[model samples]
Target: MDGIIVVNKPKGMTSHDVVNVLRHKLKQKKIGHTGTLDPEASGVLLILAGKACKALQFLKDTDKTYQTSIEFGYITDSDDIFGNKIEVKEINYDFDFEKVLQSFIGPQKQKVPMASAKKINGKKLMEYQREGISNIDVYNEIEIYSISVLSKENYSFEVHCSSGTYIRSICRDFGYKTNNLCCMKELVRTKVGRFTLDMAQNLDEIEIDTVKLYPLSYLLDHIERIDYEPVLDIYNGKHVRIQTNANQVCIYDKEKPIAIYQRDHFDVFKSIRGLW
Candidate 1:
């Protein structure tokens, strides 16, 4: 119960709903999720159980991949098909789609949708939208690592992007670039960091005896690791002397991770977080 659980979240169920179900099944109170997926969207949802909940901050910067469908010729209030229709326009299927997809590659500023759960001034943006206050426009830096077309006929494509990149916003922008109104028709998170859909299980399939909890080390696979000599120093959360060029590294004791250490200054390393 001190590791990660990958859940294949079903559409129409909120992210919290999935967590609640697993909490009851496992009888574990410290369970939490790595990130939230809209109830309308489905796919890989990482559940951090027991002590694994503390690893949340470490995983937040991991990139994510999604398979999404974009519907053209109509726009919605929420930037998705489930929202109320706000505008309609003629479809321009003849546009150069591949060129447009390539244009989105690399870094850019993306406006966060008002219908999203992003907080502003201590209140969630969606809550503001519910109260008829929709003037807030917030933007954040995001990068699209890659985008590959799956089916032009269905407007389905897969995108690999930096964490926090909103596929709905991408669909909306795609429509603007193509001169057609558009919205995200469907979305499925295929991957988060090293975890993928192939590793996830449907909520009903997660029985306590059969459910798998990936070790905490799997969460830090993207980070570098070093076997240092000072074991007690690492355990005590003290700065340890080391000589490595990595900005941050996992201090390991044999097969187990003792703690994650960030370079303090020169060759010294300080505890970012202890695994124990």
Candidate 2:
């Protein structure tokens, strides 16, 4: 009951709604999600059950990938089709989508949608919008690793980006760059770090008490593994120094991971998270 559960989220249910359902069925009080998916969007939603909630800090920085459809012709206040229609336009001419997609492949400052949960002065931006607030200036620096069209007929495309990147906002920006109004018609988060859609299971398919819990080492796919000699020190919350080729690695004792360590100083390995 204390590990990660990958849920293939269904559209129309907010991420919190899924968590509440699992919490009731699993009978575990402590349940949390790695990130959230909009009510209109669906895909991989990782639920941390019981003690696994502590793993959020470790996984929060992981990158994400999404397969989304950008519907051109009209724009909404929320940047998605669910919001109040603010503008409407017709496609007068063909536009270059590939070139515009490539231009977003680096660091850029993106404005937060008023429909988003991002807070301003301890209040959600959406809350401000509800209070008749307009044009609240807020921005987040995000990095887009890559983006490409998956199918033009379906207006489907894929994007790999940093943790907090908003696909809805990207759809809004794409239309602005192309001189046409656009909004996200659908969104599906296909991947979160090593967790992909293929590895996800539907919510109805899980039995909280009987579901197999993935080991903490599952998140260490990107780090190198090293066999270290200090088993007692690490278990006793002690730092162990070891020379490793990688800047960060999973330290193991007898093939069991003790902790994820990073080279903090000159040859000094510090424990980032305890796996055991």
Candidate 3:
């Protein structure tokens, strides 16, 4: 029960709902999910149960890819098809979607969606919405790594972005950027770093012993491993020295990760996470 399982989350269930369902089904506590998927969205949801929960930080550092469709003739108050309509415009069939999509390839600033999980004044933005509060003072500096047009008729596209980027905001921005009333119609997260839809299982599909593995295994290409005695020193909360050309590195005791070490501006090793 102490590993990560990919759940192809069903629509209309909050990420917390998935955790509660799995908790009831498996009868194990201490379960956590890497990222929150909107209730209307369905796709890869990484569940970290038991010791795998410790790897949450490692998984959050990776990128996410989603396949989403946008409707261009109408906008909703919630920015998706499920919300109340706020605007409408005639669809423009001649617009250059490719070039418009290309314009958003790099870094950008986005306002946190009103219905998002971001908190303000001790309440989530969504909570604020229910209480008739609508002002937010936060914005996110996010990068859209890549975007490709999947289908022109329905405005389906695949986007790979940094973990915290909001796909709903992208849809909202695209509508205004094009002077159209746009709303997200459908969304499916295809991947979260190495975890993909193909690796996901239903609640009935979990095989406890067979599905769990050390999450740090996904970062092997970017990290150098340590095999010496400092593994125990760091585990015991003692400072230890290690060498690495990378800024952050993971120390391992044979096949198990012991700690994540980082350099002080790439100069000295400092343990960041202790797995022991």
Choose the strongest candidate by lDDT. Answer: 1
Candidate 1 lDDT over 1-276, as tens digits, reads 789998999999999999999999999999988889999999999999986777677774379999999988898889999999989999887687778888999999999998998999999889999999988989989999999999877988999999879999999999999888999999999998888999999999998998989988888777887887768877888888887888999888887776889988998888888777
Which one wins by TM-score: 2 or 3? Answer: 3
Q: Candidate 3 at 28: error in angstroms?
A: 2.4
Go through the candidates in order and give the C-alpha RMSD of each one to the true structure: 2.1, 2.8, 2.8
**Segments of candidate 2 deviating more than 4 angstroms:** 209-212, 221-230, 239-256, 260-276
Q: Least lDDT summed over 10 consecutive residues: which range in candidate 2? A: 52-61
- List per-prediction Cα lDDT, in the order shown: 0.89, 0.82, 0.78
TM-score for every candidate vs. truth? 0.91, 0.85, 0.86
- Tell me the lDDT of candidate 3: 0.78
Which structure is stronger by lDDT: 1 or 3? Answer: 1
In the range 39-126, model 3's lDDT, one tens digit per residue, is: 9899988887776677667654468999998877887767888888877789766668888888889888877788788877788888
Score candidate 3 by TM-score against the native.
0.86
In model 2, the clashing pairs are none
Error of 1 at 16 (Å): 1.5
User: How much is 46 displaced in model 1, in angstroms?
Assistant: 1.2
Question: Per-residue error at 275 for model 3, in Å?
Answer: 1.3
- Model 2, range 28-107, lDDT digits (tens) per residue? 89888888899988899888876567556656437899999888889888999999998899873477777788888999
Error of 1 at 34 (Å): 1.2
